[model samples]
Target: MQTFTLNDGNKIPAIGFGTFQIPSDGSTYKAVSAALKLGYRHIDTAVAYFNEGEVGQAVRDSGIPRDEIWVTSKLWLQDYGEEPAKKAIDLSLKKLGLDYVDLYLIHQPYGDVPGAWRAMEAAKQAGKIKSIGVSNMTPKIWQQFVPQFDTLPSVNQVEFNPYFQQTALRQILAKNDVKLEAWAPLGQGNQDLFKEPILNGLAEKYNKNVGQIILRFENQEGIIVFPKSVHEARIKSNLDIFDFELTADEVAQIRTLDTGKGMHDPDAPGVGDMLLSGVRFDNVAQKDSQKSNR
Candidate 1:
């Protein structure tokens, strides 16, 4: 299995199983179980996803040894303060039914980041989290956050793909030796993106699908990815990119597809206001509970 060595000397699988927006009502469990069975060594979830329980349940039930899987979770904006962040980390561990997470990330750039960083650093020292990082951080946001910690973030999870390559942000990560993990790495299965001649041509040449072309590009660029999929075939196919390499011309061709479109503009005016309002998983959890009781 291909893995990236984090600055802290920890290794993370190059491709991870993402559990974003996966439902807890057995869908997350089934997806996770399929991922494990298909040889995925890394699993990612977040407090904001509200499916950590299901993800964890699948991992434990897979009969896979705990040490073999790299589990990652994130802290929500609601758990930004020092004490709350600390408590939230513990709560996440409890939800995942794990003693420690391979990597823990701050879900967004807003909130009491300093307090949260301090808490995360403490957790790292205490061995509760193997490594820590920030997600959805722009070049400017990351520069601001890096100075607050004694060490730099081990990973920076970003919305990276052919559409929004974030080359500038990637330069910063390279300089700081931080691993870049691409979330929504395949452009969320956007048909327009998949249909691009550059990707399609590469897909035809490589005898792989557009998604595989995109994933191979990321792997060749040394970026980590956690592509989300509820389908078992897609999950297995996503992990099958390790056998090929993209040529320089092909990589440059894909790079031209970057239009800088991402899920949100980190530098947009008053962006923090919108990010602070982030995903509300409570209502989703409540609805799931109601269904379970029925």
Candidate 2:
């Protein structure tokens, strides 16, 4: 697996397995175990996902040394204060059955983020987390946060795919030595993405799935992608990008698909307000509130 050098000099796998909507009925455990067996060393999960314990069990049962795998989790909005964030970190560590996590992120750019960053930075110094970052933050939020701290973010995980390219944000992050991690690299199964002519053409030329073509393109562009799939075939195929390389022309062809937007922008006007207002989970109450407010 190819690795990217973080701003702090740590190496992170360019590709990872994401467990966002993985079923909680033991399927998450099985999927994670299978993924590890299939040679995946990076795993992305979040406190909001409510499956950290299962993922931790799978990792422990796999008998793989904790150091060999890169485990990442996030601090939910409800736990954004300094004391609360510290407690949340302890809870996350306990859930993952580890003393430290490879990476810990501020799940969203909302809540008391400055307080959260203070706790996260403390965790880093105390060796409770190897690296610290923020997820779903825009360039503006990043610029605002970067200057307030001594430690820079090592990574910024966001919703990125062919359609939502994150061009300007990528440039700003690159300037600050932060790597971009894509959360929905396959666009959460958007039919239009699978139908793009350029992607389809590349799929045929490489004898790969459209998903594989899309992931390959993003990987070549230096974006760390965590494509989620419970199916073994799809997981295997997603990790098979190292075998073939896309040409410069092919990369350029796919670049035209960029819409210069994010499909899941946490920093959008109303969305930012909701996040900052302390909507912790994607439960019925939160869903209803978001709908009514919109």
Residue 41 in candidate 1, Cα distance off native in Å = 0.5
Question: Which prediction has the highest lDDT against the true structure?
Answer: 1
Worst 10 residues of 1 by lDDT: 285-294
44-142 in candidate 1: lDDT tens per residue?
Answer: 998888888787788889999999999999998877989989988887877777789999998888879989989999999999999999998998988
Clashing pairs in 2: none
Q: Model 2 over residues 1-294: C-alpha lDDT tens digits?
A: 799999999999999999999965688888999899999999999888877777787888898998899999998988888998998898788777778999999988875888999999999999999999999878888877668767888999898999998988999998888999999899999999899988998999999999999999999999999999999998888899999999999999999999887667666679767756754554532342233223
Model 2 residue 71 distance off true place after TM-score fit, in angstroms: 0.4
Quick one: RMSD of model 2?
5.5
Best by TM-score: 1
Instruction: Give the Cα RMSD of candidate 1.
Output: 2.6
lDDT value, candidate 2, whole model: 0.86
